[model samples]
Target: MAPVKKHGRRRASVSASELAQMGVCERLVVFEHRYGKRRTVEQQQAIKRGRRAHARFYREGHMDWTRWWRYFIVFLIFGRWLTLCVAKWFQVRKPHHET
Candidate 1:
């Protein structure tokens, strides 16, 4: 016969420190059973605020990169065209055989 387990199921509880730890790693509270307590209104609000803050940060960072890329592309095209114009104005050409 299989040996019976002696330990009972553990109770689920969240302390203030656990709440803080949850902010760092949500999986920390994975042991909480389905019968455990639900999140409070304040926690829900904080989660919403965090999501908004992260979205704003992401948008602002990408906006800066998009603006920089536009300037870089414009510079590349205009610089190359200006360089060719200047060279042509100076009549830079090789012998016909070099073509």
Candidate 2:
């Protein structure tokens, strides 16, 4: 009689870009992508943290925490107004359809 052998989970197809996004510490890209493993919130936050916190305000239409919090009391109000004005300046008029 022959003995049976057990096997672990098989590896999935993973790409290098995904591995870079995951910040794979060791040489384990496909393994991590296949298996249930993820980077901590703190780690991810630190890795790409604060870099674009204010990008929302800078880019317009997607405000997160309002990077320009130098003066939360009144400055933000004026700053928001100014930002809106600037955004409107570059706003492209989308054509209205009369269907």
Candidate 3:
């Protein structure tokens, strides 16, 4: 008696992020891949503002900031939290002195 061979089905090659993006808007990923980004007037204005800010910073040696101030604040908070965590870890690992 001859044994029958079973064939496995092949799955489509698609990433989870890509699938999620597609779920949001099917044509968005396709459009991006095909023609690259199409910036809106508001986005262009924002880019121009950022460029001016950057140039001003270079000339003045101080940042004339924008919404990035929020990012800076968030970064400082995250750094503080990380420092506290590391300090706590070291304190826990350090041997206590007996009086």
Best by TM-score: 1
The stretch of ten residues in a row with the least summed lDDT in candidate 2 is 1-10
Once fitted onto the true fold, the runs of candidate 2 whose alpha carbons sit more than 4 angstroms away are 1-27, 47-51, 57-99
lDDT of predicted model 1: 0.73
lDDT tens digits by residue: candidate 3, 29-95: 7777666667799988987998899798786654445446878999999999999999999888856
List, residue by residue over 27-96, the lDDT tens digit for candidate 1.
Answer: 5455343235467999889878988998999999999999999999999999999999999977976667
How well does each candidate superpose onto the true structure, as a TM-score? 0.56, 0.25, 0.30
**Pairs that clash in candidate 2:** none
Worst 10 residues of 1 by lDDT: 1-10
| Cα misplacement distance, residue 88 of candidate 3 (Å) | 59
Instruction: Give the clash count for each candidate.
Output: 0, 0, 0
lDDT of 2 at 97: 88
In terms of lDDT, which candidate is strongest? 1
Q: Is candidate 1 or candidate 2 better by TM-score?
A: 1
- 1 versus 2: better lDDT goes to: 1
Candidates 2 and 3: which is better by TM-score?
Answer: 3
The local distance difference test score of each candidate is 0.73, 0.58, 0.72
Indicate the residue-level lDDT of 54 in model 2: 54
Worst 10 residues of 3 by lDDT: 1-10
